[model samples]
Target: MRRHLRKLRSTPAVVLLFLILLFLLPYDNSFSPRAAIVSAVPALFEKRWWLINKPGAYPVDFSQDVAVLVKSGIGTKERIPSWLQAHEHMELSDLLLIGDFATLPGQEYQYRDQRLPVHDVLAWMIGRGYMAEDLDHPRLQKYYNLTRAIDREDVGAAQEMSGSFGWELDAMKFLSGMELLYSRFPDKKWYIMADDDTYLIQPSFKRLIEHFNPNREQYLGNPVGGEDCRFGHGGSSIILSHRAVSHLTSDREYLATAYRESLDETWGDKRLAVALNRLEIYIYEEYAAFFNGERPRTSKITKERLCTPVLSFHGLSSSSDMLSVSRTFEHATEQVLWIDLWNIPTSDKSDNAHLPKASTSLFDDPIYDTGHANWDYVGRPDEWTQSVEDVSSVETCKQICREERPDFCLAWTWDSNEKKCHMSWWIIKGDQAEGRTSGLNVPVVKGLVRSCRP
Candidate 1:
């Protein structure tokens, strides 16, 4: 019995020895569980860190932006909804749809073989509360009478375009469609219009217009036509409140003339702008970031500049591209870093693009030149615009904007005292503050300029 007791006592020591060898010692001939565990420890922590910091996982921080809004209601004592409450108000059913489709039913988009932008858009729209009667070029008789893909004829044009290029037929179709849609669905609170090539992030779009009352006469879109005549870039899509649509329908003669004049215009977007302008329905600059002009897989600038949840992108030609964009932004992937209506980058910059150099100014370039003679000074300092710390000079700022953001850098601002420069890919004239040195990307500014009554 004593010997048995001694063996039991010794067993504990033996097990402890085995565990120590198993965990602490490394073996050359085979895999080391101990080493694996040690390496995995760091990896486990890394994965946990990533989960905690995941984008869109938490509510957005809009303390500063909200404060700005509160300041506007100084004496009135208006109640301000929390950001969460504002987001909750934007439901899918709140939107009324008007999509622009070519009379030709199914054309394969630019990138993929089987994927069709029209069919894809239609399929998603079917059960999503959008009515068939509401769409532009609604299937009156089913053009080909072919239901399935296997039944259709050969694929036609890669993309359906309007205005000029002898595509006047398509442009006229849009004008007529708009007139009919508004006539039928005139009472809907909000009308969202987009071409087949457009794909909307519904949640993002809802968040954008939640603050605006549907009863108000608000026209929201990316502002084009420079400082004079601003309109939304229709390719990116536009939202019209009931109040704005009323202006279109209230007078029959004006509507008739607008439609007739639009038939001859080179760009359908311009034609639409002219009609709206006649009604004095000005475009609101706040929603400009929602209009992304860049094609998918092109650049990150379009995503960063809006500084809001991305609402819609214009150049998603392929179904695959649309799917990717939808999935990518389904969860807020990035936080809106800035809240200025304009003067934000389209997308965030690469993680390691430019770092602050020093506290000293690198170049003595005038804080304000006669301006980039070619460029218009799109006001600044850009909203929530971060200063590039080590850039040192205006030349470096200009060079960085030119090389790094060829597609996105529309305008930039420099602060000589702080030895910093900031680049803005998007701009809002309303956000323009005085005494700030600024420059513009002239070519881009010129492209968006439309002849407006000065």
Candidate 2:
């Protein structure tokens, strides 16, 4: 099971609305009339928020406000206009980023300004001065030294790497970057290696790092495995904890030997995997779920119903796609807050929700199969499930149910002792079964449903 979702972290506007509701709403039975007025206040505010900030209401058009604001260097209350402003001042300097860049100016320099600040923040592992005829240039020597330091003598060729040469150059970049970054920032807690095409959501990445222990030797990223070794996908992103970096750097000669062996590999990720395998370290796979590239394993349909927050989306080639995804994520976060805080119903949010809510179907049996084995739904929890704490009041469960399809949310159970709320499409029978689960079918919420649709 996933850790409890941090849905309570909401936008400032939602927080203000909650504060007003908590204090201004009458809590006493003595003030019955006032209480009735207070109850209506939430509904009114919900509509107001929906009308102003609904997903469809604010289209992702960068030409409108984003361009104006970005050009003027005016950031919203939550975000900084410039990439460096948001991170350069942060205390988490212990983390290092190593990004690979190609020699071509057409692709590399074209999007330099538009490139996300995530790459500029850390040490970029690239051969900047290799284009010059003189190999003895200080910059070229630095590049040469970096390649040698990483133990990949096959990579630091004096000539520019073009066409098919990219493969070997990329592998050299990865090994060189790891060695250089470790040598530069030996005490750093985490290191992220990514390609120039990769886009990262830095804030969410920080949250991921904060949630885990960096002292241990762990690797996090999208898992791409060959027959022999499984490594974090470099294109998507690869995260190495301090211990992992330390382990790799602990033996200089051994690292050099491994690097030499991996020089023949086409893919840098595969080469890294080989090194990790030889080192007897396993890669942790959860980060891959969060850090997606061109192919997203998780679909849009299931992502909403589940309470987990998506950390990043990779493989965005164009600047527009990058900006769009970034804004979409921000907007989705706000929509979730409105849904949870205002108890907005999930009406036609997905095909699953649109297909008969099980309430209106006359012939369809609304009741769930009562007698099933323990854990009737035994698969892993996806984005379609929600687990809240202390949903003892049916009202609370009904509120969360509105965020999903009425038919899909078959039942909900609340454990008083644990104060855990487990919602499922599956419903079980019996008075206190193996688990402290309880609740009615989706039909019970038909009258209570609130539509988010226009």
Candidate 3:
């Protein structure tokens, strides 16, 4: 009996020990569990960071370029709405769209006027800081009345508010636009923002912009001076610069914290202007020049300078006629050998082969490569834009272009800044052996290669 009891006690001890060993043992699941984990890692290896402009990603090896983006809301009718109404869809251009802000609650704005540079109306909102007491001001009531006057129909507040809302919102859009634009083209030097209501006749604006202290990180529209700048209004229409706009819109919280109270208080012109200006941080008071410059007419400084210190702002209060003028210019757009990608002539390409040459493998080359686009073994990037491998047969190339929806694309010179495909159609030939030095008269679809603007 003594031996039996001892054995039973020993059995309990042994079972406890077994449990501890089992717990300590690294148990895994299925097939040699350790081998399964190793194999699983092979599948995980396929995922990787994607980089554009990498030698292994694009056909041509280069980076950097500029982009011109427009901002407008089709609150109403169609001026030339297919791609962009800002420049009227002219060809040979660099244009991007900054969505129309909440133009109209219902998408239909008071469409009777395209000639008014409504931007001028914003002047009334400038200056001033929101205060706690102004909540009872009678002018606030009037401004709200004005907002209601601007738009009629159901939904959202009519112009019951003053320009403060618009100004703040514009600042938001401007800042957001800059962040997004930079993200797309990490190396671009500047961003030019334009409006749809004006007549920007300065074709050399970019060159002039570059000429001005290319090293200076920011610029003003057209510099002007006025002792009364604080109490006075100045500036031509153009407001140029590259600084972040956060400083201008960051302080709306004091009044903005309570919409019901603040909206009712921002009425009187003087007080309202003070509150708004407090939020607008101008890089330079150069705005005064845009409004009070020596030349009232459009200034043409030798392709490099504006004859007048200030550029003209013709589209205020009346832009319809000017818009018509722009349309007339569009008619003159001619297609003269500008499709660079469509194999110009060998002589032309050799003249400007500044770009690095890239070799191509047939779509399926089979010779240690990830897989050829044609020859499943040649190792060029699958994402890179195609560079010409052989141009001996020009007619065959043309045939291919025609068969593929007759789209003629401008040759893209890789931009290191933006690190994406960029084509400068605004100034280039299309039919040359290599590329054109002029614009082309292609269908809107053909214009799809770049922006549909001249």
Candidate 4:
């Protein structure tokens, strides 16, 4: 009986020793504790864990299936080489710069040591009978005279003529450019048209295009007008699939009508939308958030667009601004989100970084005392506003912003003259306004940023 008891005690000790050895063994072995524990979990959970820990990386070269057309004019053509330099890393397969006038047949224009074959869409339209000189209107006569001056290398005369009729010529570039693109590179899966001042983010643009079928008709952009005459804002950017291009260009009778209509239309983008509506191709309203009509500094970062990918920014007319934005994302390894734009510095001398990083704490609130004078943080249409009585000051304005819900108030502006307080749900780096003061709710903004993190 004593021997049996000793055997039982010894068996318990042996099992404990085996367990300790299993845990201490190298993890590479199948029987090792770490490996065993990992194998016991479900495959789905394991995949999610791997995804969370993986590096954020995207493809660098995906422009083979895409073609980008940049609209320029003789006056604004000076910015072309700089724009090209900003996007040189894209290695685009076909990037044609089209304007109101074309280069001589078999001749290319030289700018800043770069040779680019510039197409004259206006000339093409006249050749195909899509455009004719209206003796009564005199607009076509002025356009023809300008082209002739350009052909003769008379820079002074061309510049002077364009100053007066530049806007009129701009309306004609849209359809003519589209026709030129269809005739030249119809095989491309995607076609993107942008103004000289527009900046396109390549990674996000590629992601957006990949989401849709290239063979189907797709027209997308930032819708600006009402439902009656809705169209994508020209300055933002316009995207068209190969099928959409074919629908518009295949019917010559419709093209002629569209071209004639372009002469009377005030905005080319609206005219293009009208032409597409006839062909049953309307704007893709669902993806409007991807396109921004404002530059980075002035873009409104709303909660609805916090996590959305940004494809383009308009009004980057300055070469330095374009270069600055390009450098900001040149080395980006992941997709550029709207939330990411908040991090751009507000001013050249400002060491303070924007969103995703908390630059200040509400606890140390010094902004109220030295409120931003002569500044306006523009509010959204649904923003809150109220007039204050008695002591109407910046402190009173900021207090109102603080008392509101975090989601409803991210910034505030005070009108000193009217003694009114305006609260905005958006975080904007505002512009200058006399007799107004503005401030931001930094803590709330930081909390919002934290909530959006992966």
Best by TM-score: 4
lDDT at position 298, candidate 2? 20
- Ranked candidates, highest TM-score first: 4, 1, 2, 3
- For candidate 1, give the lDDT: 0.44
Give the alpha carbon lDDT tens digit for every residue of 1-454 in model 1. 9999999999999987875666543222133354455445433322212113334312222311111000001111111112112222222322222222322445422221122122222222232333343334324223212123223432232122111122333343344444444664565656666654565545455455554565666677767876557777766777776676777667766755665454455565666666777776667553465565544333233223423344655565445544444444444433222222122222323232222211112112342332332232333344534457776766777666666775767666655556666676654322233334556544443343211100
Q: CA lDDT of each candidate? A: 0.44, 0.43, 0.31, 0.71
All candidates: TM-score: 0.43, 0.42, 0.32, 0.76
For candidate 4, lDDT tens digit of each residue in 330-414?
Answer: 5554557776775666563343322342233321455533467787655433424333444388887787777654457777788
lDDT of 4 at 396: 73
Question: What's the true lDDT of residue 348 in model 4?
Answer: 35
State residue 282's C-alpha deviation in candidate 1, in Å.
0.6
* Whole-model lDDT, model 4: 0.71
For candidate 4, the per-residue lDDT at 119 reads 78
Model 2: lDDT of residue 145: 43
Candidate 2 minimal-lDDT segment of 10 residues: 68-77
RMSD to the hidden true structure, all candidates: 23.8, 19.4, 23.9, 14.0
| Candidates arranged by lDDT, highest first | 4, 1, 2, 3
Candidate 3 on 117-185: residue-level lDDT in tens? 222111223222333434565544444444455545422343223232443323323333333344444
Off by over 4 Å in 3: 1-86, 90-102, 105-134, 149-197, 212-217, 228-235, 244-312, 316-320, 328-454
lDDT of 1 at 145: 26
Candidate 4 ranges with C-alpha deviation above 4 Å:
1-61, 104-114, 133-136, 348-391, 404-408, 415-420, 431-437, 442-447
Query: Candidate 2 local accuracy as lDDT?
Result: 0.43
Model 1 Cα displacement at 32 (Å)? 75
